[model samples]
Target: MSAFPIDYAAVFQALPGGVLLLTPQLVIADANEALLWRAGRERHELIGRPLFDVFPDNPDDPDASGMRNLRASLERVVATGVRDSMALQRYDVEAPGRPGTFEERYWSPVNTPVLDADGRVRLIVHRVEEVTEIVRAGAGDHPVDRVRMEAELYTRAQDLQEVNERLRLAQVREREVVLALQEAMLPAPVPVGHHRAAVRYRPAVGALNVCGDWYDLADLPGDRMAVAVGDVVGHGLAAACVMGQLRSALSAAARVADGPARALEVLGIYARSVDGAESTTAVQAVIDWSTHTLSYSSAGHPPPALLHPDGTVELLDGATDPPLGARPEHVDRPEAQVAFADDAVLVLYTDGLIERRLEDIDVGLARLAEALTRHRGADAETLADALLADLLPPGGATDDAALVIIRL
Candidate 1:
């Protein structure tokens, strides 16, 4: 024998508790039979109407807080896409026949969000259990005791709401502090002689708009400039502090070292001592305008791109090595140099610019090269923006990205 298919619509109507389907705007879309019976209202009166309009607060009661609490819970579900369980609430509904009379009601409500394919809240499932009879059961035998119990419940609900508000404020303050620290750590790029250069730093999206990515540009002695991009291994305030220290150490090393490889070697040594700095990746490059040479070294990072005037691209991956602090002992890092034409553009970036979830790194590199070749004719600033627009998603990347573009 074959089994029959399930009817979801019928099941929804047969649910034991009062259920309401609401839009993100709090409009009443549908109501189950149990809810219609409990609320003492017909389907036509409640459907196609705003939830608050249909069930407004009891105007005679100045202390009525049912509407406000329910609205807050629904709005929270829409904003964070998380479920909210409301405490016992005392609400009074209008009588079926009397126009101005109200009947006392108690409810326990839970609001849940239904997300679409793109992780956006599409609808809200508002389920409520009526407990009016339980609240009034001991009224005849012990009226004073019933009043005391109701008061205690109301006080507890108020305390919970206050605590939730405090937590939300604390989270906002923490995010603000992190953002300010990130801005202070990443300073503006220093002028690189007469070379046209542009740099862009974008943190990851969401509440914590900060991460462990950094970029540096400094003018070296003898008509040369050094540019570096690095990624620390974490997020939040701790990773940001570590990033600041490593970036400053590398900048100091680059000022005194003879070449890019020696500067990274110094950074690798420093990273081993700092907490939360292991497995960090960085690429340091120095461009000499006099000889038209680009010298670069990498510590487990993606290669830099060189776009020529003829729409040709070259990736500088010859000097790649393991990430910082990956080895048990110190090892000499490798360095490579390539000659570029005067009209060539040198691009150095963190891995977030091209990397995507579950995709091959080589595929991302190929995509970057293609984008660079197509925009070879643009200026340094324009080229930087174009590369980000082409490589990043419409909503932005999941990791931090630091980019440096220089016209040779």
Candidate 2:
């Protein structure tokens, strides 16, 4: 009715916690979605009603303090024009479909005064946090004995603290083991011929243990060499063990298989036979230095990016089959080939490098291409460092990422 329009319903409902608006006389004016759900009442039933009339204390119960405490807090907020917080109070709500009955509820409520331009109290914002679960969960065997309830809560808190400490120590030990496994497995001084090779690997931050990201380099019978980057399903000792097994199996298959495609096919078969290597994605490639040819195969993995000598970027994203161990039948690992000019860099990476929660993979892929174009003409190590810096600055990755760059 006033000249000023207040369309604050949408804004208040957008808040994460429960919010209620009360008039200067302590009458219910509006309530947000959170508070409506928490109170289990309709907007028509609460709005334009006096607060005490809607939620009066039980007359038969001598221990009813909800009305008294809430009234005292709201009075103080109105008098001093300051915020006041009430201790946890058991406020009962009218039972659904029942006329004059109530259900017990506990809430931690805070009352804040909203002042008008003239420094007069316009409205009161009542925010509540339900603490019934915490109270009921810690209730002791003797419900009437306050001393027993407090003692039980103290004992439970000590037990929880001890359990947390043990879990923390176990996580530390698992991380050390995963790190040692990675250090022992990942190739160092990567095997290279006429072209240069540089590798970078970063484990996910705040990981309880380790992840299943790995990279390997192996020499073939011809002047070509095999390189691979892969990720298993999960983290910790189980995934780390599976990664080691798959790496060894892929390396062995590369020696006997005809090309990169065949090598991945063989590796897929081996992974299916393993206990934990199922549902893994990998990119395997054989680069021939003499012919300057690259033959690569993918198994449900992100496509590789090729940075030409002239800074033109290409994504070798061809049709791919499902990940290993997806089906009993052998999935075809499709291979793609491209000839590279001198100083060309080909990067094979895991999804962690280019995937983020709630974002399209195309966005990340474009960023990767841009980074490659910007860092043209740099050597393998420099290019890799630059790409990692651009894509994953500090504390960026939520999953493990590995990169293998081959410069011809």
Candidate 3:
């Protein structure tokens, strides 16, 4: 399987128009030749540069509307993902020759957004056509004519802003519908044979859109209970629908397969057959109290934390395969076993529980182990609540968080 789901860099270069790829933070990650031609610079000079740093407003001029207008237009494009066309921009750039000098330039620029699989902006496509001649032509017009032109431009900008607001409001409503559908499909807390299990799910902050995080508990034959947690890549309605299908398939496979390992293998097959679940990460476990054994398998997922009765914490990092749909060949889903004693707790969770921006995943895992160790004696529900309250940010989480605890 390819390392990157999409080769956006290649796509950007192939396009005929000038293009710039920006990170979510608005830093330039790449630039195409058509864009470089306008700047009179090579790829290395501008590839990793910030947009404003590369072309700041000419400081010598008192009316440097370049920076002000450009910034406002780009902000609108990023926020709304709507294509924006400016009437005429007088943004100026540094002159190639004299040091500490500025050059005046006129341009008609258009900005558009490039979205990733999750419906989030991954890049911004900025295209410009030099309109210096056309703009200069208007210089001979009467003063009153110029004022009328300026008023028309202002009216058009207002119309675009109104349309953009409507688009954002509609998107919010659609997200709510998807969230309701996902919530309705989730199973309630239930008993699995002799074991009792509970799950907690929280949607990510901002619009409460549906995501692909899900957890399930199944009662298997002969005193066996199965638990699984998974996260699908991306968000919105398509991801939620794929998550629902995978959850049902995994539950059915757990009941028929010989063990957790075989069940994961079967699930991989089903995941590939489905249209949207190939990039999912998951962990599945079958706990048999009668045998006092816990068998589990991981598919490119964070290992489960096991809290022993004697205050020992163990992260079950066993032989694991790549995410479900990444491999086409037969995958060997090995099941690792550990002794399950009465009153011991096993915590299964999605990556959101331990993943944070700017923090290493190992650090997050260590924090979880510490939290579980501190609350080793509490009931499953109390422990879950404490973990969330302590770990999640006060402002709110940026991704969906789901965790399941099976107390034996």
Highest lDDT model number: 1
Return whichever of 2 and 3 wins on lDDT.
2
Task: TM-score winner between 1 and 2, please give it.
Answer: 1
**TM-score of candidate 3 to 2 decimals:** 0.69
Error of 2 at 299 (Å): 0.6
Measured by TM-score, the strongest candidate is 1
Q: Write the per-residue lDDT of candidate 2 for residues 104-168, one digit (tens) a residue.
A: 66687889988652234679999999876777666645767645754554465445445645755
How many residue-pair clashes does candidate 1 contain?
Answer: 0
TM-score of 2: 0.68
Score each candidate by Cα lDDT.
0.88, 0.80, 0.79
> Where in model 1 is the C-alpha error above 4 Å?
1-157, 356-367, 393-398
How many clashes (backbone N, Cα, C below 3 Å) per candidate? 0, 0, 0
The candidate, 1 or 3, that scores higher on TM-score is 1
TM-score for each candidate, following the candidate numbering:
0.69, 0.68, 0.69
CA shift of 275, model 3, Å: 1.9
lDDT of candidate 3 at residue 222, scale 0 to 100: 82
- Per-residue error for 100 in candidate 2, Å, reads 37
